[model samples]
Target: MKLVLEGIGHAFLGRAVFEKLDFSLAPGEVVALLGPSGCGKTTLLQIAAGLIDPLRGRIRRSYRRHAVVFQESRLLPWVTTRDNISYGLRVTGGKSTSHRQIAERRAREVGLHPNDLDKYPVELSGGMRQRAAVARALAVDPDVIFFDEPFTAVDVGLKRVLQDLVIAAAAREHFSALFVTHDLSEAVRVADRLVVLSEGGTGFVTNRRIDGRPGDRSDRAIFDMMEAWSRDPAFSELFDGERKGLP
Candidate 1:
């Protein structure tokens, strides 16, 4: 396993978010963490990414390095797209010339135009900013990437485009990922396996493998799989009214 969480549990103030959660990510695998609002999906991702320490748990990360792509672009407004993409490299002590070279390469890989590299976040469209954010995460050459509902803000067409970029990048780079999202279709599209959290953040609902590889599934097949899951009793809570409100 690239990462493992054993008997994990956490709380805020006096309230518990989750208890005794066990999760793992294998090398080059993408696992979608799906749950309803306020079920602590983001909280679990943060713990897995080492952004926060769980109150009671042991986390073992065997990878060399990791990065995160947030729901918002979270770009530095003061910096140009090029600089934003290269920021991680610079922080890790890369030289100026090499940083520029690598940043441009990653930018192009994420479909950002050469001209757009010089523009600040405010000048680019929402989808373009997200592209830059993804480019930034990829620039670090991480062995693991944590995605926190990264595509929820974009329109449907652009969302698919960005999701494809993620699928292609994961296939080519062979990086493991823990993707947190409420959208079942997006999870079905990007992950090799699915793990669901129960409402109220008590524990897991289910953990199961998808039928096919991430990029190999056809649109019709994806729709059919989702339809089947929707009718499944295990997935009933996902579509219930309880999934709404809070978080």
Candidate 2:
């Protein structure tokens, strides 16, 4: 499966967010979309997911199935954790033991305990809710999954665990991803390629292919790589005060 965005342009209230931007996501590849806060990363994800149409671009998608995990968990309060995780299946008209089994397996993979599946979203912690959201997305067996800083609300330890879970899932399922994040460390750890947006969200600053397996890299190794890239002359603008620099 593949996704392509050609000559994409968007604006809000006469303020141009981005214009004439071209991007693509190849099959089985994970691309991290990095930018400063409010730089239209979320907007880009929305457009790519077909939730909104770009005023000046055409989007082409070859994937038969796609799913998105927003910043918020957005689980239903009235449903059990397992039910919330299976929401995608229900929406797509998949009602069977097979779908239920997939939901249960995905929930477990995301670190939700077996006992926790019967509880409501309000009954789970913030991280648990986020895990359920991810499980729900994975349950749909999408060929591409878009994530919009879904780990920002979790604590550091849980954040890393969730990142590892996503990496493992992506590898096992061979699905592609467009991960929108401001955290350079997180981006480095999860992406096969990294692309940074300009400060005004008008264009791309850089597109770098990372070597080695991001999912297998140690945190210290990823941090060192991030540090080196931040100091590189080509990426200097990405670390300037106009944008959220690497940590």
Candidate 3:
């Protein structure tokens, strides 16, 4: 399955955010949208998810189902973790018993204890809540998942763990994803390809294919490549003469 955005453009508060933008995501392929702040990364994700229509664009989706994990966990406060996880499944007409089982299994896969599934979101730690959100998204077996800087609120250790979890989940589930982030290393660690937006957000600056699987990249290797890319003209030109450095 694939999602394609053609000639996309959007605006907010009477100001243009992006224009004439184009991008795509192939089946089982993880792509990271890396760009400066306010360059409309999240806007693109929203457009791709069909949450909002672009001012001018055509979006095409081959997948039957998709999901999004935002920066916040967005768990329903009144529901138990398991219930929250199964909400989508139920909405999509899953059988109660089967959805519960899937929710429990997904919770465990995302590093949440099975016993914790009955607790409310307020009872869990931030990382655990994020895990529950991930579990919720995974329970529906979506063909694609859109992640909008989902790990930004977590600690470094937890961030690394969650990153690994996302990569593993994508590999195992065979779902494509669009990970939007300003952090270059995080993008490098989690994505199979990297696409940078032009400074004006009018078009793509470059599209780079990542060399290896996330599991195959060591810390030193990631650092070296990130550093090298920071120096690459193709990477640097994305800034369009701005003194701001790649994060």
**Using Cα atoms with residue i matched to residue i, what is each candidate's TM-score against the true structure?**
0.97, 0.94, 0.94
The better-scoring model by TM-score among 1 and 2 is 1
Q: Write the per-residue lDDT of candidate 1 for residues 59-93, one digit (tens) a residue.
A: 99999999999999999999999999999897689
Which residue ranges in model 2 land beyond 4 Å of their true spot? 233-238, 241-247
Any idea how many clashes model 3 has? 0
Ranking by lDDT: 1, 3, 2
Cα lDDT of model 2 by residue, 1-247, tens digit? 3999999999988888999999999999999998777778888999999998888999999989999998899999999998888888876775578777887899889988899999999999999999999999999899999999999989999999999999999999999999998778888999999998876855988898987776788868887898898887656665664354436
Per-residue lDDT, model 3, residue 145, is 97
Residue 116's lDDT within candidate 1 is 98
What TM-score does prediction 2 earn? 0.94
Off by over 4 Å in 3: 237-247
Q: Which candidate is the best by lDDT?
A: 1
* lDDT, residue 22, model 2: 95
